[model samples]
Target: EPQGKIDTGAEYEAPRNEIEQKLVQIWEDVLDIDNIGINDDFFSLGGDSIKSIQVISRAKAKGYYFEVKDIFNNSNIKALSKCIKKNALTISQDEVVGEVELTPIQKWFFERNFEEKQHWNQSVMLFSKDGFEKEAFEKAFEAIIIHHDALRMVYKNENGEIHQINRGTSEKLYDLNVYEGLSEKEITEKCDEIQGSINLEEGPLVKLSLFKTHKGDHLLIAIHHLVIDGVSWRILFEDLSKAYEMAKDGEDIILQDKTTSFKEWAVEQKKYADSYNMRKQLEYWSYIDKFDVRKLPKDKEVAVARIKDLRSVGFNLTKEETEKLLKHVNKAYNTEIEDVLLTALGLTISKWTGEKNILVNLESHGREEIVKNVDITRTIGWFTSQYPIVLSSSNEELGMMIKNTKDSLRRIPNKGIGYGIIKYLSKDKMEFKLKPEICFNYLGQF
Candidate 1:
């Protein structure tokens, strides 16, 4: 659907050298596509931020090393292979087990001091026709806890001051709770129960529950939000599947080589927060802070809103419409899906509220290449950044709106990473004046 110079009907060129051949194989395995040519583009073949991390990790396992940016800059195998280095990056073999500094997101969480901190988590539900083996699942999770340093994180409250530490992996990491003959309703309740059982102070912030139902087995995994984000889930699930299969087959459970650790990223982030570059963005954020945000009219006002009080209305676009939105329409304006979606949202909000200026709280993956020589493509942690952006819906024309929204997003510094740094980690913290009621996030294709 996307217009490009590469001819799909023509004969494709195969990998020429060992590096290119290895890269092609890795890309095929990660993307789950067959016969990826050296000239093929990564994004055209369904490559995204998450899949790029997978490719990087798989390549590193094979003794090849390259940054995530290299993949973006050199999308094709031939060009990427040239940038790949034979010498591996200096990743410490020892487990990162010690006191770890809280990142900007973690600091933001602590600042909130939610009512039930332990119950705040990110979770997933997986179902399989054939039930999983408890032994294999435990072994797989144990391997994961040891490899991903952040999974073993624990918090300690010392005289009103909170600190985090990565506990040693020798202790029991996971316990498989197996329930027999649970109905769908009971399984849902059990998931909620497990979600509330995560202990932040002690250790093992991750919980796993297995429910055996009439149809199939259900697996529920709940991890504290302090250590995991959307991108981290992809890395976790991929490693879990691979490790579980190896354990089931009675083979040694060996995952891919570790990338930069979460601890390293946190340290680098602290340094960057105090750097001159981060300080320069203060004026921009201050300008954004001055935007006048109007509160949306609510049907019923309540003192407090909780999960139980929330309601959602679902909508779906037809398959043909989705195709145009994702691919075909982008060609006309040279825009991304976010630009178009945000334009529509801004226009709708402007019509509803009768306001031209629309303020939105935007969330980004937050794994920007801000620090030099620090690669977190495969690292797992709560690397999400929240920042505010004001979209002007003064122009009603669709084309002009798309162009304006795209330009507005382009003006953000490092995908809004510096906002969190300046707010939570800076020496002189200033409370922001404008708080956007609406939040928007676009999770790219999984």
Candidate 2:
């Protein structure tokens, strides 16, 4: 046991109604906050996707369940309580433990070395002008490593197949390398140098370092993509805030129990892949595979060597313009932005290459309703699904093209996650087919 403990006593207005009371209890337990107001925003109070799952999981245990989207859309306790009342759901088992199979995304990653120059390690550097306790941050990080299973994961090749092995509880925390009085340029160069040096086999695929400067300490957190994604970052940061607060006061680091272990999700996914429902989904993809659409043409042909290195260019629209455009388009065509974007792309490519039809790879969140009663709102891993879509602009009219794209996207089974099932998981001997040239994924607003 640690020598010192932090006091978590605080005061706030009490819950007024049954729904608010129950929600308050749940938030207090999950967020480790002593007193929570009904009007408090979830994200403002450090609630994240993973914790959101915990909220849903706990609410179901109390005979109320709501959609994860509801939580995202209605974040405050008052709004969430109303949502629960309007949409009460029966409790279902949402957790699984023990060794798990590799998900399709993981299999795809391991099949080939996606990283040619550096390991698939991502890092974020944060600097604060006000100083903070280094020891407290270290303890907070230690708690996070124990709370999240993926952080302590390692891979093993068993009989020519790779499997993710969760270490359960880890007693070790990542050592934060500290540098004092370093120049900003030197610190950046040092961070870049360290970013390329992660060893996947050695395990504990996350690294952190702190650089002390006149302003404060610059913290850099690096993690491998195999076990984490964009949503996971939100959860990790939220937990870190709570943990840091606790550790600063020498309090015991406590986090809400994890809902579903990643291993359990993988096993459930594999079972779903082999089920009759998945076979039906494959039929949908089979129909799509019959079309041999033209690929998007490039300005110039590049050497094979240059294919490994890719560059990106981006443009942005004002918030008002973007929201209005989406609203007008959806209202006019009864479609989402994805349909409008894909239709525009198809039209642009058709005009550029003089091709009536084209093929593009589309990526999705992959958290489709494949398995029953399993909520992964809090579960984190790379749940990205990649599939090919055939787009045609034979009519040459923008409205017709939009309708064609909307109808085509609507026809996809399971939002295209089924594509991976047919191509990768199906036991039937599969044929080698050409893949889409241009990949397009609309990542929801940052």
Candidate 3:
């Protein structure tokens, strides 16, 4: 079998047909590229799941209805053009669906909202060498909020059930906090003071504060975790940088194409829950539920205190050792680093608790290949999929344990996304709750 060839510098022809021309334009707009060729591959040009959703959303706006699967299946502009279902439906580029159902992760957050609200916030502080362009940066920032619908969501409770409503744009701007001539301690205190003050119920989840100091400008952006995740931040930063540069140069604020709205995803998820594959996976989970696992040690059986004080502890191996474990050792055992890590965890926990079998909750990115043409590459929201996995440390040999862990994970249908689908969206309304005490997640690389 012959694999595809790589020719980065190869020249390609322009789009021929009218459909191809329009598709090329969409590709250029979504990928932030200029003059995209008809033959250019979508994935090769930085089209991810989120971006794929944007492409389809933009296409729908242009009266060319298509799904994410079409983009994946077609791959190129010419092929995608032929695949799109031409329609006369006209939807505004800025108009998004209102009153959407809460995603699984969002529901999880709401269930635990009795505790500290500020802990559910995701924030970053950026120190740019040169001062930011006041007008340009403001416009760029506004464009970002307008482009992503999730950034404009506010949660509301209807009949005791919480739902997210998409409110268009906000009049909020990046207010500058003057910390000039102030001591370092004062600046630190001011930042902390502002960080602790954010209303979760506010429509606009994203807020910015600029600190003008003697050295340089420090831009602090804080967004609620319900609207943005780790991957969403990367897309936001990239778009911000590009938008800022364009606006500074007196160019039009043209962001990449819009992805599928989060509201649409919620509707699709409901439909997918009733699917045959999802039903089959639910059966598998039911079968696995029969086995009982040991729980971790805790002070109180029925805890009454809210989890207020939380902290993170990080550990990293040497670069060489990390690479050897991730690449060489994984390849030799025909397994992944996650499997090895999980097996090691099982061994370590068994030693501590004296339990051969244990159940732990594993968090997945939740962007599985379920709906054929739906893409969420650029769609930002809490899309975490959490499921329970039973790990056994009964095996004495390390190799056998690793193999067992890998096999166990491989048995999960659609990366455990089906669990969330069935639990939240299924019409059966069966109460299936499996809460594992310990949670494990591996973020590959940021």
What's the TM-score of every candidate structure?
0.90, 0.77, 0.76
Which portions of model 1 miss their true places by more than 4 Å?
A: 1-41, 44-47, 74-82
Tens-digit lDDT track for model 2 on 1-446?
11221121223445788888988899878766666776665654545444665677667667676766677678767777777744432333332224557777787788765544236775688778887678999889988887676677777767867667776453344547888899989998888767767655556677888898998889999888888876667668768888999999889998654646677677777777778988777666777788877555667776463534777788988967764554344556656667888988988888788887788889876766577766565555777789888888786567777888888887887788877766666676255364888889765432
Q: Clash number for model 1?
A: 0
What lDDT tens digits, residue by residue, belong to model 3 across residues 384-418? Answer: 88888989899568888888998999898877988
Deviation in Å, model 2, residue 212 alpha carbon: 2.4
lDDT of 1 by residue, 99-142 (tens): 88888889888888888889999988889998888889988998
Best by TM-score: 1
Model 1 lDDT, residue 9, Cα:
33
Clashes of 3: 13
Worst 10 residues of 2 by lDDT: 1-10
**How should the candidates be ordered by TM-score, best one leading?**
1, 2, 3
